[model samples]
Target: GAALRTLTEATTPALARRVAALVQEAVRLRPETAGQVAGCVDRRLEQGPTARPVLLPLVTGLLDGGPEQVRAALATVLAAAGTPASRPLRRELLESLLDRERDPAVLDAVLHAAAAQGDADMDRSGGGDMGRSGAGDPVEAPYRREDEIRGLVHRTGLLLVRTPEGATLLDRGLADLGRHVPGFAARMARWLTEAPDDWAGMVGPGARRTIENLAGVRVPA
Candidate 1:
């Protein structure tokens, strides 16, 4: 509560960023502090449009921390940004996080946030294409969004083949998306199947087997 009050009163970007960083650090050290961090973020976000610059660095910098810390920071931000007022910033942060995050739990959180947003966006559009090209021209259609999601999923799949906890993270994300965004999971599976390079070469141990199991194609021996 004090952190949030201080953040609400923060007058300069420097001060705001510093406070945000401390909040993340606290969450990292003590996950029980996540509620406080979320509260601080929510208060800062309520400060209006100017909060973006302050929050951007705070949210993005969490990825540079240890995996557990990153997961903590992601959970904090995702919970705080669930409001309509924070939707735009949340989307931006989600995209940025998904773009570079390598940790499985963090990636899973990002995908969940994106899928939730997509569900909302789709609902608001009444399930219609958002004024894009016709179905006949897939290339000219609204592809930028799809491309971003695809790249993130592909990168995560690569990690799934590499990291020890990758399968657990992916399985969790798949289960979550299966409920809210079934197509997202399908897209990830498709990307894994059509990966440009061999997943085995990306990292050591469990790589080939994981890829083979998920993608249903054996790596040549």
Candidate 2:
């Protein structure tokens, strides 16, 4: 409570940043403070650009080393702060974390965060096509977004499938991605089917079935 009060009353970006850093340290020392600290940070972010630069590093630091609760909280905060200007940074932050984060709960948060930001970005840009260029040419934004999502899926899928929860989270994330990105699920299914036999065999039956259901494909018995 004191932490949030301090953040709310902060007179400047520097002050807010300092308070946010202290809150991060508090979470480090007392994991139970994570929810409060995360709430404060989320509110700070609502102040917009000024608070974002200050809190971005704080969130990154927490995600890097804080306890599971803190990481998940910050991940959800990022998901909620899905403004167009923050999309690239948010995606990058989640992508970097997914590469090294192994805890299922944390992975769940990160995957959902990524999906939320991706969908928000697409929606703000006017759905899958992301609007057309002035010269009647297709805009490159959606293509870039597609590339970003493709990289995320390809990189995280194999690693996440190693555990049941990770596999399930990955499936759900893909389903979310498919809702906004045209044909993403079908493309992912193709990727899965085309993988080497060894790699395909590594995916458990439950994981495969979940993926198939979302992707609208049925593997033959």
By lDDT, the best candidate is 2
Q: Across residues 106-167, which tens digit of lDDT does each residue of candidate 1 receive?
A: 55555465455445545544667766334443321335655655555455556564575876
Please give the range of 10 consecutive residues that has the lowest summed lDDT in model 2.
195-204
What TM-score would each prediction reach against the true structure? 0.58, 0.61
For model 2, residues 65-174, the per-residue Cα lDDT tens digits are 67788878776765443554454556555656666688877766655554454556655566645667566866557657655655555555666777877877766666
lDDT of 2 at 176: 62
Q: CA lDDT, every prediction? A: 0.54, 0.60
**Stretches > 4 Å off in candidate 2:** 1-21, 24-53, 79-81, 95-100, 125-128, 132-140, 158-187, 190-203, 219-221
Best candidate, TM-score-wise?
2
Q: Give the TM-score of candidate 2.
A: 0.61
